[model samples]
Target chain A: MIKNVYDDEVPKVVTIKETVIETPTVKTFIFPFEITEDIHPGQFVMVWDLNNEKPMTISVIDKKNNLMGITVRKAGPFTENMYENMGVGDKIGIRGPYGHGYELSGYKKVLAVGGGSGIASLAPLLSFYDNVDLISAASTKDELVFVEKFKKENIQVHECTDDGSYGFKGFSTELADELLKTGDYDIIVGCGPEIMSYKLLELSQKYDIDCQLALDRYMKCGLGICGQCCIDDTGYRVCVEGPVFDKEQLGQLSEFGKYRRDAAGSIVEY
Target chain B: MLKSNILGMNLKNPLFLAAGILGTTASSMKMVARAGAGGIVTKSFSLEANDGYENPTIVKIEGGVINSVGLASPGVEAKKEELIELEDIRDETPVIASIYGDSEDVFCEVAQRTKDYVDAFELNVSCPHAKCGFGSNIGEDPEMTYNIVSSVKDSIKDVPIIVKLTPNVTDITEIAKASQEAGADALTLINSVGPGLRIDYQTGKPILNNVLGGIAGPMIKPIALKCVYNTYKTVDIPIFGVGGIKDYKDVLEFMYAGASLLQIGTSIMYDGPEIFKNITDDLSIFLEENGYNNVTEIIGLSHEL
Candidate 1:
């Protein structure tokens, strides 16, 4: 009857309560019962679809009604299978709520930026901060997700699309840079592509604002054991030390936006 | 119940975290020690910082994993920071530094730099995917193994030296004997096997970024056991057996095969850090049930027949 996911390595089988298609490529899966472990906004959980296991950020955590949700984009073989084979009531394996999440306790005013499916990890931060600004970006208006949801949460929203099909015409990082100059926020947080995060880190340094970022890397184990997710030079495992890191820590990374290793540990251009 | 002594260092148990897994950082290694490991063998490091290989360093096969991480390290100076962090646990939990280099001078230099920070040294002469002349290249030759181990041994007499050997060699016992004759206090058998390859069905490209990588997991357990068994018969020093250990049954098999201490690597990914605690508990129970006084009783029992 142990409730903590970290107590066991084997994944728990949970029934899919519902599925909300946020965009053509992204969907939020709802599980019936709350995983009793305390989970934070930016932390993630590993989803085992029998074929493979991949980490997905926990997009929604509803503790009161016994519900938890993970937002996933159809990125590869594993996610593609999730979109095609999974349905309401279908049993899937899940473990974790792993890694450190966003720490927003002391900040007075905060701005959060997310690009594409990266928005999923930043969505829950809105609940923790009363004075917050959020930017959701995608390639096009049709692909921009959670806009209506953020609006409903009474937070200010800025939507960006690459094709000029949405609110801002440029990339989300450009918009974030503009905001950094105009706003007097004490803290900034972001999740998205590495390029966007790298830009945000630069802006944070330029604006003298503390910034935290959620990173993605190739990981076999969500725990810190596997060195696959380690960042070059720093040797920090994104699975353990991060997935969420602040400005000071992100500064030490040499490969920030330039490159990333593929599944085979071969470096590829980011 | 699992307590044992290897190379004059007292361990609470025979299970130690193998080199190159979670031992990259002090905090991570400390976490594993807190979880129940008796000692920690750090990820192999060299004199200069190396970026190692690009991703796709590791891939999953049916029963194990292949990795070509290329021994990515932050060099001896940066690694010293992590070793300093482990200094507090040097008394209760032994910290063994695993170092590698291309020549005897390089090996001696790394050992000399790190000797003060750790309880012992593990010469990583066995990494299958390491660049030419560094890992198995130095270990595959008896004279090379003797030269590297003797050089390292000469540099640090205060701490015991354990030479990690490769199984890809023609005869592992020959290399083991060479290391022992060269004054190595202990030996860690079978650093991953093969320059194994896997392919992406769609791309028709090799799965590992390096094209070929060292293999480790349950599938290599039998081979590792045989290596340890044969080497134990050839050498007098304690053997540190590693490769494909997942549970207590594997631990017993290794112990009975003449491994004085055991190292768990790939299984830590599948079972998490809890694997240490779980295996120790099961081993304690197994010892009591079988009327064994301690873990040392089973060492080399398989050779009795």
Candidate 2:
């Protein structure tokens, strides 16, 4: 059974029950114990690979079987270490189910957009909401993940590949724009590259649709004190106030798609 | 219950959110106030926007974390927006703008630009990891520290000027005396300590991108207490004690060590914004248990020995 970590700040050692290789870079590590807290869609947990603690979204939460899962892409040092060395039964520290998740209760029809590894974050949302139009995009056909999982659940899925290897030969935002014109979606939820989310923000405004975008930023302490995850000029902390933000809130951010601060707090082109 | 006054600004308590930790935005600043800080010091800003450094700016070590954020700021004009938001909360929580610059004139310019939106100015001459000739470089030299503080004091009228001092020096009181002589209304003791480093065993490279950064957290608490304890003897102005402060016990220690106000930074990372209220509540209980009616009764009590 996976050990449950009680504290928000302290890490609890949990045994990895299974590891599923989703793609070349992305993998899902499942834990045996249930996180008793109600982890909403778009919420994340800080995983400690012993080298460093990093934030990752909850890709799967199985309460009945007492299991939890997180999908990770080998994007940085910490994730790369996990991909290369970690295996089932390997004990890794996990803390928190932090941040406000997607508020998907009132919406009748919804559109979900996921880009690259962002599909993992969208998976839980698709599971919770029945009427979701899912768009999964990747750089290549093989890189596209969770296509079969969505199909198995009988959810309608749209695929997009930047290299034109799959369903649509364009960006996910472009596909979302095309879908927005025809489908009447009450709310659009997205998690991906900043540029895509920024574009989605624009399209949401253009289409007059309510949208929520899950944002990523450099975070230290997930509990809102470390200002590392702050958005430019606006001062909203992605760790606390977001990681998931509605269209109106994202509009106020000046650095949305244009820039992001590095770990050193240096602004770099996103 | 723990009301205190420092530099003519009234405070509900001695606790403040230190600059450069979580003071970047007005919303976060207001959150800190709502969480129970007597005042909020903004993340240090300059005359122009600075990108700071690259990735791996802050690394957590055993005792604390080392950060070389390089003072990344949105410049004063952009920072004014956050300051304006802070103005709405100024009545509940006083706002202090922490400003840093390369020269005395630049410091004066930033002070002039931001003076209207804040209750006071904290001259940041003590950040150990900032670019050369800006942070500790200006602070380490008595004459330079005097020049910067006096220049800022001259440029701004009616606003209290607080000099934030570095602990890297051999004699902190020397610098503290210099700041007092130069007309500083108050002082915040000890920025982070050392251009510290943490090397990754597998990579065999420094963990921080800047190679070296200032250390803040539990490791520096003793040093900060000592700096405040000693500097209180040298300067008559109020001292804002900061460094590794975590709980109500640390608050009492700082108060006994002669700090009129306490600034919390690294602890906020571990405990979150609620730490202010937690510490304040616990402190109130400790004071009542000890039969102390006012927090000032214990200020500098250790010096009597």
Which whole-number lDDT from 0 to 100 does residue A46 have in model 2? Answer: 78
DockQ of candidate 1, scored on C-alphas against the true complex (2 decimals): 0.11
Query: For all candidates, what are the clash counts?
Result: 12, 2
Q: What's the C-alpha lDDT at position A177 in model 2?
A: 88
Docking quality tier of model 1:
incorrect
Give per-residue lDDT, candidate 1, residue B101: 93
Report iRMS values in order. 8.5, 6.7
- Writing each residue's lDDT as its tens digit, candidate 1 over B70-129 gives 888778987888799789887778999999999988988888888889989999998999
lDDT of 2 by residue, B1-305 (tens): 69877777788998989998887767567767777888899899998887677545665555677788789887888788778867678887889999999998899888888788899999999998888889999999999999998888788879999999999999999999989998999999989999788665434556555778998887799999999999998889999999988889988899899999999987775666788999999999999999999888889989997
lDDT of each residue in A95-196, candidate 2, tens digit only: 677888888888888888999989888888765777888899999999998877777877778999999999999999999989989988878899998888
